[model samples]
Target: MTELSNIPHALKGLNSVVVHPDFKFPDADVVLSVTGRCLYEKQLLVDTDIRSNHSESGGASTSDDDEDFHSQTSRDRRKEREEKNNPEKPSQATLFKVHKSVLRRASEFFADMFSIPQPSNQDTIDGLPIIYMHDDPIDIHNFINHIYNSDVLHYLPLRQSTFNMMSSIIRLSRKYLLLRLAPAAMFRIRSDWPTTLEEWDKNDLQVVAITRWNAQVRDGSQDGGSRLGPEDLLVEPCRVIRFARQENILEILPAAFYHLSRLSSLNDPHRPRSCIEGRKRAHGYWMGGGRYATRSVLTPADWDTLMIGKAEIRAWFVNFRQYGWQSIHATNCGADDPSSCVLSSQGGWKNYWDEVIGVQTRKILAQDGLDVMEVLQVLRHVVLYDENLCSGCRVQAGKIVGCARTEFWDCLPDFFRLKRPNPWGGIWMEGEPVDCFEQSI
Candidate 1:
């Protein structure tokens, strides 16, 4: 008989002792089998089988757990993708449109400030002018007076010089009014006032004012001197009132109130019967009562209208008079003048030498022509501001502020080519640069 210990534990666990027909157990009586050992081994085999069954059940649960983890990961990825595909909304800004009357008012206001002659007709572009205010060394009052005396009917020639002077003023004013009033744009012109006004209105501008003064002699002052004696200067005081619109009857309300307020404050027993006072006192009497009244009621709408009108006026003049005969002449002169011309057919070195040395020498030798200093001095009074900027850089530097450097630079290259100094230091130019000179600079 085989020892129970040597038999496999699982087979030993079978308690039934049956011998095969061909096999026999030797010494059945005398030789005894170890049943206890077989029983112990059999129990161990049964425990092992039970453990294997539990392991298989655990593996099935693990597979289900892996599937759940994979599903959660996919859900997270889908949520992330959805968020990326749709974004939040963005905010918007407000925009406004202006009326024409406002622009006309602004143009007129500027014109009044500079004492530029007012346009005589409703459709003519005559009252365009410039006002200079700032640290400009030039005397604005004197400059305006010179223009008045010179009999320069059209003002396009003054654009180059005036642009430099006026840019500073506009920049300063822009800074001052930025917080108080939002100005999206500004326009300036030296053309007929009526035409400018009409164009501005057509653009739905909000404000308008002319910076130049239209000169008008009092009815009796044809001979340069007043005919009446000092005591006999009893002249009827005159006041000019600008309406918002032809149909706007209420436009006069503010003007009337302003006039009444001034009248109440007057100390003179013979109070001037004028919205603006002192019309009867002197030959060159000037008053800006209308400005005080209008400025008090300035609004965003007013600014829009004013700016639109100015832009329209500028566009019109730029389109029509900018290339006119006078403009062409001035442009040509500026292009040819060694002092103003940036380029020449002779090359950069030759042009620089001629302008810096040759032309300067001639200027020193030339005798003084007219005492235009007086004229310059007088123009200072008429101009509200002045400034200068180089045509090379987009930003205008030097004592001027608030103007965008980029805008100034962009405007300069073309603007500088518009005017040229004569041999005597007078300005002239108005056309395109000569083709040969274009490549040399």
Candidate 2:
């Protein structure tokens, strides 16, 4: 257990027993002394160029230069001065007075910890046993808040802050063996990042709608300029990918990678989208509209996986264009000559690719389309609705497209070189170990 004196080191002269405002249980029997750095301060390599040794607990240790350290020290001193003047600020909290029963009920770690006989010389604060932890104070607060109020797990409205909170809960829950909370958190994450083709379509449609809306507003075609921007509406994929990799959340990796791959590879031509765009700036990429830019924090290995997976998706589309439709056998044609209809269907497919598909692909993605889901939807819609195409060819096209979509989704894990865990796409059942990510990642 960390001494109470050590609390001042992190809190900067703040009282050792500064209780969390929301977690100040009246009948509390334990004090959780959260002594970890703020979550954002624990950077996992801000720049891809700066390499550092990673700790076993998945934290990277960067060797900050003298100037960086000096700047950090100056900021710390400024914060300390501010806190000294306003000591009751919520950010000054480093202690949580929580119930042991709640902890034991929610976490196996706490249950085991309490089950053990306490030392005769155990330290106590306010006549309660003190349990020191090296987890972020905000994470501890979020974890306990979730325990007290289950509503913290609701990941609706998909904001970066929501994701960050959920991530903190997931990380701490997994650390302390909160079996139910951990899996539930994972479920929320998977829900946001589509794992199935149908879900992907829904997400893509939302993005498409937002992109069009933003475009219209920008061009003075739409009236609602006060509406939320794309950045406010959409969650960035690269950040999700980073958290997933850090926590070994393998199931969400395929969808995350796929989404990231869809963004334009070129850098933002306009001014920096964010303040974090200078010395330690992240790489920038954008989707179609250009109203919002995503700062990507991908490592070399992640980039390699993304590039390789994207290439595989593009190759699948190219191969499907040439050979996939050829195998479609048109049956029960309403045409006078069924053979002629089949021949015309093949010609229609060629013309569709040449005129519609190829042009759209180039215009949107600036290359051959890497988004298989989008292309598949377009192809199916044209085949089904075209007045000229026979019903027989339409049905065959639907089946072929459906099968191709499924095939592509199935290949996502392999395409990204990710090991898919059993019982993916939902909350894990009781006693089903949730640490199913491949050990080697």
Candidate 3:
């Protein structure tokens, strides 16, 4: 057992716990410790049907008696094998002891497996039948962890390992056909993505996860500034978008593309969309190894779609600037006078607006692939709550931006070039998981 103090140091998760990657038993990195018991461990690796390691209950008998007993046992075993329709049980079988009732209740696969009439050679330990699994042991451990602890989702802290763990849970849940467990896994995965501007603002962990998924970010690298660069943005969101597309989960794409475009510089044609533009700022490694490298995971079609969406969003900005509403007299409207507020209502507001508000908003909203939360911050900071600007002009500007929002929301699907519009026809909201079994997990 890991000592309580050592757990903080030993809070290990997969560096890249991918979809059942090449694995072996007794690996130091992959382990599960819970409820004072550990599964899928070296000590627990046992061949249930074999008793080579077992000790006799009593002293050894005479050679003649032992020979007679062994011959009789062999004859009984042969008879048992010949009598049943079940395939010959393995002379040696790996064991995982779990509650039969839990398996029966949680999965139809288990229900069916256990439904088979017991073989005479079936093995047991600690009052539980030995249920052998052919899956990667790590996957089995993760899935069983969820079954044992329904509140396990809440226990997951915000960290780089979080997504990888959840991915493992989801894969196993789907494979075993754990219908109830599957949605919960999907829900947590879906929740990692922020749907609204508010959710985006509050979630730094998601950003860290997005950043860490592709490139490893070290501790203390997160400085509260414009430290996030395009290199940080490209790999993770694109992979996620690809995942969503494969899974037929359209809801996750709009925000994903929006973030991707901002990061990829798709909105700004002047800025080159170069992959790995500079010598890597943060030392990191590629998770996808060998024939499929992480850099090439984003398919060509995905690249084209993201670029198109970026161009489309930038085009909207161009249209808005050209025809939506431009202030004619770029000056202050003293109570009664009329003045347009494109940059700002007052002359001073123009300088701050150009340098601070508009520029950052453009980068955050159009160029730098990120969420709108930062842009909203600029808006809140720029919009005057006092008697600095005309009430009528404020209303007009508000109405313009409001209308722009509606237009933007309506066209997000077209922005991302998705084949079919999301069912909500807008940003995905966190709620009941999509009910279609085909697309559920």
Candidate 4:
């Protein structure tokens, strides 16, 4: 009894004293007791009695198990009942279903707003809900914004003409004109001016030529002199018009204005005729005046009929697929080998050689050719192009050409050298040389 009392007193002292500053009292004592119990059990000096009690409710309870089985069971039952009763329970399928409904509603709302009937054949592709509107530029722009903002449309493929038409509508609306013009000025500086000049000859190229010629004429003559050189005479707007045709300006100005109008109306809600009926009415006035027009609007019913037409949709798909295939094949063929036939390149090979080779390679290799190197190259091109090579492959091709002697073969993957020589004879795991006797002769 005295020994037992001394043992308890010794345990209290051990529990009270901190083993380490980081270690707490109750936790350390509990750990030490558990360790001792485990050792005693291992030595057969003490047995760990894992007694389980079968409760009156047919539930089992174990020693040291703090969880109340009755309470857990009750809670689970309540949750099940709540889930069954609740109509708005969050679920993936439900969320998707709700999204689909919301998109449909939004489409209907916009169609009504524009006085255009929705496409009857409204369908979903790969979880993306599509709403086809009448090809009215304003209505189309609004619809694009609507779907884009709502996150209903995942991918949009618009015809170039359609995009241009919408842009013109936006520009004429006057809401985004200045902002649109700002970007247009930059674009003119970067691309349009250079391209236009390249297309024209000396007589046709007026703006830059006139400006330069005038400056030269001013510099060549005395400061206040009125007498001009032949170049200076050419600098006059009247002379420039006569050199070209006045009709060219008339033709170009309307088209430019049309596109500008479309661009300006893009984000402006206050812009009138930014809807199907409004655009159609506007077109009626414009067309009645005997002006050359690229597009004419239709009634809501007519628009819906057009949108739902199988042939039209099929044509769109065909064009889109062709364009995508051409773009991809162009990249693949033009890549590395500059001489290869790509659609973007000037006349080289008559057909896509890379695609032909790719098909044959697949038949031979029995696997996809796009591996880690191809993936890495794609990533490198996307990320490193602008920073390193102005987003053009010309510099990369040049580098390859410069490093052709040693780096060319080294750059190629092991699989590409399937026919390369194995010095260990036929016993080696690696393949034979590409120009081996069996392959060559």
**What is the TM-score (0 to 1) of candidate 4?**
0.15
- Counting clashing residue pairs in each candidate, in order, gives 84, 0, 3, 18
The reply for model 1, stretches above 4 Å from the true place, is 1-216, 219-300, 307-343, 346-441
Cα lDDT tens digits, model 1, 1-441, are 211223333233433222111111121211111121111111111011222343465511223322332243336545444445643321111001122232233334433433555444322111211111232212222222222222332232222233222232334333233221112111222111111223313321211121112123234235633322221111111111222222122222222222222221222323343534543332232121111222334445544443343333233223321122122111222233455433222353334334432432343223221111122222222221322212321121111111111222222212222122221121223465422111111
| Model 3 agreement with the true structure over 368-412: per-residue lDDT tens digits | 444343444445445534245466545544444444554454455
Query: Best to worst by TM-score, what's the order?
Result: 2, 3, 1, 4
- What is the TM-score of each predicted model, taking all chains together? 0.15, 0.63, 0.53, 0.15
Poorest stretch of ten by lDDT in candidate 2: 44-53
Which candidate leads in TM-score? 2
Best-performing candidate as measured by lDDT: 2
Model 4 stretches with alpha carbons more than 4 Å out: 1-248, 254-258, 261-322, 327-441
lDDT per residue as tens, model 4, 175-241 = 3233333243233222211212222223234433544555554455564323232212221121211
Q: Each candidate: what lDDT?
A: 0.25, 0.59, 0.45, 0.27
lDDT, residue 182, model 3: 71
